[model samples]
Target chain A: MKLFQKMGAALPSAKKLVSGLLDESQPPVEEDQGGFGPPGGVLWTTPLDVLSDRPKAGLPTQSAINAPLPEPAPALPPDSPDRSEALERTGLLCTDIEATSEIGGFIGACLVDSGSGLVLAETGDGRIDMEAAAALNTQIVRAEHEVIEVLDLDDHIEDILITMGKQLHFIRPLEKSPGVFLYVALDKKQANLGMARMQVGRIESTLKM
Target chain B: MSTDIAATTEIAGFIGACLVDSESGLMLASEGGGKIDMEAAAALNTQVVKANLQAIETLGLNDGIEDVLITMGKQLHMIRPLEKAPGVFLYVALDKKQANLGMARMQVKKIEGGLSL
Candidate 1:
């Protein structure tokens, strides 16, 4: 009689469960597949005990996002000569000549090609005609060369100085770059010849082709 | 005068000396000789002088050229325009090791003062 009473009580609960499973309106319980959740599901849906967790669709794991980025390369020095900017080099040379205080009474200056009498670069006030000066000075240099050849002096010309009552002119031929020279003009009263010569030498040493 | 040329020739290490008419590129008188051809040197130096004069005129500095000195490794060339004769010049070349620049300049100036033409 007791066994029959227990069966009768369990039969009602079993019937309710069966009805709930068969109902079409009720949602099915989703099984967690070893932490490999369904598409578009949360990444951490798997429990810690799951051993075969697979990557979720279209998403990176936490480790990749936290990885450090590669470092940037080192920078170059500002005034390194290895840099290959030709125009900048010429511009800086002119700036250096303009800023040097040792070349007093600085009326004007130019770099000239001795062969063709062409002005490669020039900087100065409008009072001085650098083009004419370059062309004429080229003739002077050529004449000197001829004299040297005729005399067979077995020497090289370092520099030439033309002194006038009111002005002084200098022409220094470049030893490394033949057929080129530096021409500078200054006022006699304001310039120191020795200092100007030294400054010109320094400038020539640093000039690039 | 001939005596002035003699004095210029007597300077130590004097390789050559010439009186040039820079306006015409002519050598009026020449003394001493080594490897340099005085005639050619006179004509070439005249071109240098003319170029200098033109440069000064173009710049409009209203200045007269007094002298031009060319420094070389083994030699020194000096070109001085005659004060009395505006178009004339004295050209001299000397060995750098044997010549004293100050003394050479003084002697050249003295010769110029005594020169007749």
Candidate 2:
């Protein structure tokens, strides 16, 4: 089918980026294993208690890409707030990449929650169905944990790139804690997969939670 | 996409009217979708999406589905299932004139992986 062909075309480039990720010097298998295992499985706690523990985590008190207010202090905070910030960061990240429209359609993008099928973040046009979209993408964070395990591929799937038609879809999973993965979606139509992989790669390096 | 919410807003806004993440009940990006309760709409639609995925698994059709659509007399519900993540879905509502159904569905399918989610 046409879709398979596009996915085939983009695979190699995505594979190359994975090979060249930030911690690539180690080994492909261990690339996404930075803070392996959640210290406390903190990403899903309720908002109230999570907010109370903010100061301890070293993250901004109040956040959002469009928050009008100055960024608050950064201390070791709790989980939910950190997750909000992560989601907010993802929104800001796409702003920076600046994918233009006039060019053509994007590849594919998704923000998948590996743990409970929760899409923490995502951005893409209209081609794929959201119902099928989120369930299909298996790239980032905790979502791919099982895939990696079952497939016998020991590496952590920081990002998985698949090309369809002329576009490329980049699935980058974020490690919020042990159990939660912040999913990031990207469109190859307006995105340069090479640069996109690297751009998101940098964001991962500076993550706080 | 969370990355370019503003751009997505301006762009998607120009197209259909609004976009919202069906799960987690958040507006990841939106262009236009009339006076619909993006949150409630997303929540209710979860059933439609869930059934399809379950069907795929039950039928052993693991070929991977990209997007699906539900058309009503008044509106069209565009559902895109991300190929990367397993259970999340992007729900977009369009006011017929605001978008070209065929193109919007195609565009949503095409723009899946610019964000790293």
Candidate 3:
């Protein structure tokens, strides 16, 4: 009996539910507004649409977009010898001396201060003592100066060459920098003195100070 | 004995040349110096030779000097100690523009060989 009574009450609720769905499917029609419907006719709005209505102060202007971008720093060539960091401390570049190591029979090379006998920069094959050579060669420079004074040879020392039984030593004072010299030791058998001197002169010209 | 250094005139771009005694810095024979004072050069070059010798000895190179060459801005100077004579040396100067260093060295070496003193 109780089950029959509950069935009777549930049937009316089911009928009411069907009528609600039918009403939703037959919604009242309105005049077509073409594809360009009313502005607020959208069911839901996107974040872009919401923000688009606001001020554009933070956005880039048309002129800003058309302007050229800043250029990247210019790159150095692969074989360029100017090493800026190493060159900063002293005007004498080690890369310049390293270029001298490319000579045919280069035993060693150094840049020396003729006044104080200091080895500013050097590169070598360990066959020669650059420090002692720098100091001794300073004396040679000084002696040459004395000779110049005694002879009244109104000139400066360009270079001094020492030819030994098996070796050749070259000392060239930088024309731009006073009291600074480039010293190179080479094997006599493998080096051409003329070419070596020419190359050394070329390298000396590139030195700034 | 002094050599006939007059033979050195044949060298190309020859400016001046002399044979100097390394001890007293005196020229024994000389040839072809227009504006250059050969006497002063010979006397001054002797010190260069001595200093080179001292440098060689101090470095303990255990070898004798073959030659000492000074390359000046306008000139090339060569100081070669004679093999036959212990205390005598040959000094020659050349104009850098016209002189060939290798040829000059060879000619100078040959002249040094013919020198008796």
Best candidate (score: DockQ): 1
Location of the lowest summed lDDT over 10 successive residues in candidate 1 chain A: A39-48
What TM-scores result for chain A when each predicted structure is judged separately against the true chain A? 0.54, 0.39, 0.56
Reference-based lDDT, each prediction: 0.72, 0.42, 0.74
Output the lDDT of residue A190, model 2: 66
Can you tell me the DockQ of model 1?
0.53
Per-residue accuracy of model 2 over A120-194 as CA lDDT, tens digit each: 444446445544556554222222343234423334544444333334444444544433333234443566645
True-vs-predicted CA distance for residue A81, candidate 2, Å: 64
The worst-scoring run of ten residues by lDDT in candidate 3 chain B lies at: B54-63
Q: Which lDDT tens digits does candidate 3 get at residues A79-169? A: 4443343233233343358888987789999999887998988999877788888888888788778766775656788989888888888
Runs off by more than 4 Å, candidate 2: A1-209, B1-33
User: Compared to the true structure, candidate 2 yields what TM-score?
Assistant: 0.31
The lowest-lDDT stretch of 10 consecutive residues in candidate 2 chain A is A38-47
Show where candidate 1 strays beyond 4 Å: A1-84, A87-96, A99-101, B1-3, B10-12
Candidate closest to the true structure, highest lDDT? 3
Task: Sort the candidates on lDDT, descending order.
Answer: 3, 1, 2
For DockQ, candidate 1 versus 3, the one ahead is 1
